[model samples]
Target: MADHLRDRFTAFFQKNVANPVMRRNPLQTLLETTGRKSGQPRRTPLGGSRVGNEFWFVSEFGDQSQYVKNIQANPRVRVRLRGRWHSGVAHLVPDDDPRRRLQSLPSFNSFGVRTFGTNLLTIRVDLDN
Candidate 1:
């Protein structure tokens, strides 16, 4: 029941997150990770896309979100996108190129700064090849 409630809560927030994109498309990715300190699973929902070999997650808001730090400490991430789940590791771009390019893409926007304030990371999700 708890997980069900959490899912509903997440869905509710995703609808009310003041996003013009979600207003049209309600489906997005929920990136789950392990908290470095708590050692518990933490989930962050965002509007993102998949690149060649990795998944790109961006959030212009929620600058102080702990999930970002968790990913920094442990890049391994599990993502649920459009009902399909994928597991991989993410590496922060720590530069402007990836973020700038993501912003230019039609799927994502300028929300990459929340992770590093313009230092957008090209989170390289390591997949099982």
Candidate 2:
């Protein structure tokens, strides 16, 4: 019941406010995953770290996130970093400790994830050359 309400609230907030703001922010990172139902490209703003060829991020809603579900349907994804897009393959790392992973990411994003994230899920995206 509580989870349901949280989901509803989050959906409303993201759709009505957060997403629009993030989309316009030059510094914000965006994740592109195929839509599960529509099979169309879906872009979602996010925050994470890039190490070597891998991009890592922790989803606040975990599998409950629409993008995460899209990843489940198709692992292929794209990430926009520093104003450019990179193709990648997303890997869900349930065994990886999300709280620990957050420490290695950007501090501002990490703070929000730590504070608001409910079902944290670690995702690693292996970028293409």
Candidate 3:
């Protein structure tokens, strides 16, 4: 089916291409959450914005995403923005309207989310100074 192909393609591209490129890009924003099982730090490239002391981003796979599951088990996290890392506590806002939130984010990123994202979930991270 279409979904199956999309899933396979997404997995391949993310592992072989997107992740590697994002890891090296200084401008790319990243989210770091603790691994739920391994208790190791896990980082993933993301597109988001910081408002005051909070950082916001939408997950394409919602609760099904590994990072979201990690956030659920441990709210503590860190975010790298503009090459500076900041510690934060993540909060999953299931009640927030992700589509509406996307409209307020950067255009290029938002377009990708709106186009490719299937199960959108909004997350807000409260930074610790």
Best by lDDT: 2
Please list all clashing residue pairs in model 1, or write none if there are none.
60-111, 93-121, 93-122
lDDT of each: 0.59, 0.92, 0.89
Relative to the true structure, candidate 3 reaches a TM of 0.93
Count of residue pairs whose backbone atoms collide, per candidate = 3, 0, 0
User: Could you give candidate 2's per-residue lDDT for residues 42-118 as a string of tens digits?
Assistant: 98988999999999999998998999999999999999999889999999999999999999999998997787678
Estimated TM-score for each candidate: 0.60, 0.92, 0.93
Alpha carbon RMSD to native, model 1: 9.0
Q: Which candidate is the best by TM-score?
A: 3
User: How are the candidates ranked when ordered by lDDT, highest leading?
Assistant: 2, 3, 1
Q: Which prediction has more favorable TM-score, 1 or 2?
A: 2
Tens digits of per-residue lDDT for model 3, 11-119: 6787689978897988789998999999999889889889999999999778978899999999999999999999999999999999999988988888877877778
Q: List the residue pairs that clash in candidate 3.
A: none
